[model samples]
Target: MELFARSEKTRVVEEIGGVARLGELVRELGGRRVLLVTDPGIVAAGHVERGEAALRAAGLVVERFADVHENPTTADVARGLAVARDFGPDLLVGFGGGSPIDVAKGVNFRVSCGGEMSDYRGRATATASLLPLVAVPTTAGTGTEVQSFALIADAATHQKMACGDPSAAPKIALLDAELTLTLPPFVTACTGLDAIGHAVESAVTKPRTTVSAHYARAAFEVLAANFPRVVDVPTDLAARAGMLRGAALAGLAIEHSMLGAAHSLANPLTVRHALPHGQAVGTMLPYVVRFNATLEPATRQTYAALARSGGFADAHAPDEQATEALATVLIRFLRLAGLPVDLKPLGLDERALRALAGEAAEQWTAQFNPTPVDPSAFERLLNSAS
Candidate 1:
């Protein structure tokens, strides 16, 4: 048997009113000058004010940088770097969805290490340790709070870059379901599906191990049970908590394992069409599940196991039958979320599929997909979706 080592170094605070405890965490991290990273949407939604009030009540000096936008890019990081440099903060607070948190991570790297975002594009590229950071997520997706990766896109090329290092992981993840209660129905659906995609893809990626599988399976179970309820009843706090924690578990899985072709396909759609990341990935997952199952017996069985865990398939069913069941469940979520399952609804046609395939082949996550995926393979997958 092969040997594997797993590490989860971040402290997690899971409770209903966890954000109110930020003062205690700030003092523990020994933070003096603090910078809160967020966006206009979160500011308007009042989450940013609540977080700012918590830090202030802790008797800490606070500065707010609300310049971040969705799908943060090189320019956004540079803008954030300027603020961090001027403020000279010892601590950074990421207080929004994935975009703000990712920008916070990217800015930390540049402000501490002194380089462009692309300098640390791949894994472990940072030369020095980043500042102590805390994540206060307002959504239940991306799991960037727990993961050591910072996904920032290039401003010019619009290609998403994966910047990762051990130092990039948050020192603390503050999960408060109260912050997610205000999420609009569409946002809830998009982010929930993104979490589900992370769990589904991480389970069968090439780097998956025993530990990663444990997190992935647990995430799948929670998401399958609660994602629909939260989407249908936005005020369900219990269901919201389940989705939030499930996203974090799936994120931990990605930290240990990584993702697959669904993410690879989703990125190009986001870059080209400005589609939400969750919707893009969710649209492709059902097809990717079936695609990998046909070619990889191990992945087929893994999908089967996931189906059995969700109680949607018999434990003794054939790999193909189990995989089909899992795919059906994924489609059921997509449909319930009112997301399109095919490329045609997105205004793309058969003629455009080849271009999208070529772009997907260039994504870094594509290399980790269980079945070997070339542009030709992606062409077929896209066709299947159509």
Candidate 2:
């Protein structure tokens, strides 16, 4: 076995009605002046107002930055940093989905450390101390609240950049399913699949460790078991809570083990076709799984275990059989959730596919996949997805 460094740390402050407790937590953190990073959609959904009320109720000063986009760009981060600096916030609050949380992480790094985003492009690049951050997720996907990395897009090129550092991790993550009840069924379905993708990608990455595998497997089980249930019964609180927990666990797993080609490919699809991240990634995952399973029998077995643990059929089957069965299950799930199943269906043509595959092959995450992936393999995968 290879000796490796492990930095394990996560603090999730969870409750059935976390919104009601937000005021107390803010007061305890001694955050008199705070920067709240979010999007307009969240404001429209009333999450922003609710969070604002809670913070103000705690006798804290709040400055809002709600201009974040879906695939947050460098400009978005810059704008957010300006807000943070102008407000001189002692603490930061990330409210909403992954984009807002990711934006907040970027703001923390740039404001406190003073550097270009590209300077901290790779993993663990933070050399400066950062202010405390609290994350409140309104959606159940991306698990960005628990991660030390932020995925920000380049403003001009629209290319996603993965910036990571231990200092970027939030001090507290508040998980409350009540906030997710307003999510549309399709958004719920898409984000749930994103959680599944994170778990699967983590399980088979080259640096996969025992701890990452444990979290990834557990996340997969929860996502697989609860995703369809939530899609079928969107108001089921128990199922929503399960999906939220799964997303958080998946985030933790990816924070340690990183991810694989599915995300690598999915990023370009979002940049090129303007498809939602989760929908694009969900479409590419089945093909990536089948491709990876061809070279890694043990990985396939692990996936089989995940499927069985989630109560999916064919768990006891042979590795190849189980892999295929899992693929089928995923396809069915996507269909049931009303998501696109192929690149063509998502308005991606062969010309776009060729370009996207080439770009995906160059992504940093591709280097960490358990099985080697080249441009030719990526082209083949794209074709299969189409």
Candidate 3:
């Protein structure tokens, strides 16, 4: 089924300090036992303690799985699954960033359905109903909370596997923008860029629908207005709120409309260069935009609409002019965020670039690009960026 068409009883609540109300929410969902999944960073940040207090105060049993790493792998999921089995929780609370939230979902899939993550690659593959999940995201990036996909990687090969199912989508997304205030500037920049890339890429994918486009445009408008503010001044609460809401909206876009070449291209760079996902996507996005703009007039028109949505160009501007405007603005964002805009600075050579291009072509998202992409198109994009 199409993602937005699914009839899950999902709830989204926006509260500035909603983590403190987790206990109340869990009770409303009929959760007597809770497994709280998170990484060590969030524990150190003290968000976990507050959530634990709330759940405990509400008289719920809770367990902790705190070993998730960035780009969580199969090993990470297996380790988390062990904790879930020991606790036998009736519900899950994913209390950190995307990694922990995804780890929680991964654990739920295996524990409830009795299989590895690969068995549930596409939508609605779960053999049993998964545990109810309440996601309290601590960062403004990744946007995995609102979507059903769990982006776990293979431990040996580092190939990202997007495991998705309708039953695996979060039952509640509890937003509290104040939790984002403690992030370091670089984490803030990288995650914010990831959200921005989601808005831009989902706007023009081949299967984009009217509902998804509405979310993409709304996400782009808010992200474009707030990203720079948060990057330049991390303590700006208003900008932080805008970013959190924008990321969630973008997550909804990716839910209904899968992403495009930028995400497909970004994954290879991340696995090969050990680059952060946001930095990889940010560096390659402008080049992909320029490459896609030449595909056809309709694609060019879509890019133009995105440019106008960001206030980077006038509504009446020609498609070619607005397309370039969007590409230029993307590069400017790289400069503003202090991220590399090309592959040369990363020390990747022609051979390495060629290998990455080949891997990029095999990614699931590549086929969703409005223009059909092969290794040759990816090679051209990488070479130009380099």
Strongest candidate by TM-score: 1
Residue range 1-386, candidate 1, lDDT tens digits: 11112347677788898888887788899997899999999999988888888888999999999999898999999999999989999999998999999999999999999978999988888899889999999999999999889989899987778998998999898989999998999999999999999999999999999989998999999999999899889998999999989998888889989999999999888877788899999999999999999999999999999999998899888878989999999999988988876877776776678889999999889999999999999999988887
Ranking by TM-score: 1, 3, 2
Residue 84's C-alpha lDDT in candidate 3?
Answer: 88
lDDT, each prediction: 0.90, 0.85, 0.88
Order of models, best lDDT first = 1, 3, 2
True-structure RMSD, every candidate = 2.4, 3.0, 2.3
Better of 1 and 3 by lDDT: 1
lDDT of 3 by residue, 1-386 (tens): 33233453357777898888999999999999999999999999988999999999999988989999987998998998998888899999888889999999899899899988888777888898889999999888888888898988888877778898977888898989888999999989889989989988999999999878887888888998999899999999889988988888899888889898988888888777888888888888999888989976888898899899889999899999999999998888889998877878888788998999999999999998989999999999999988
> Which candidate should be chosen as best, given lDDT against the real structure?
1
Alpha-carbon lDDT of model 1: 0.90
Across 211-323, the per-residue lDDT of candidate 2 in tens digits comes to 88888988888888888899999999989888888899899888879889998898888777787888877888899989998888877887777667666655457767777
In candidate 3, which residue ranges exceed 4 Å CA deviation? 1-9
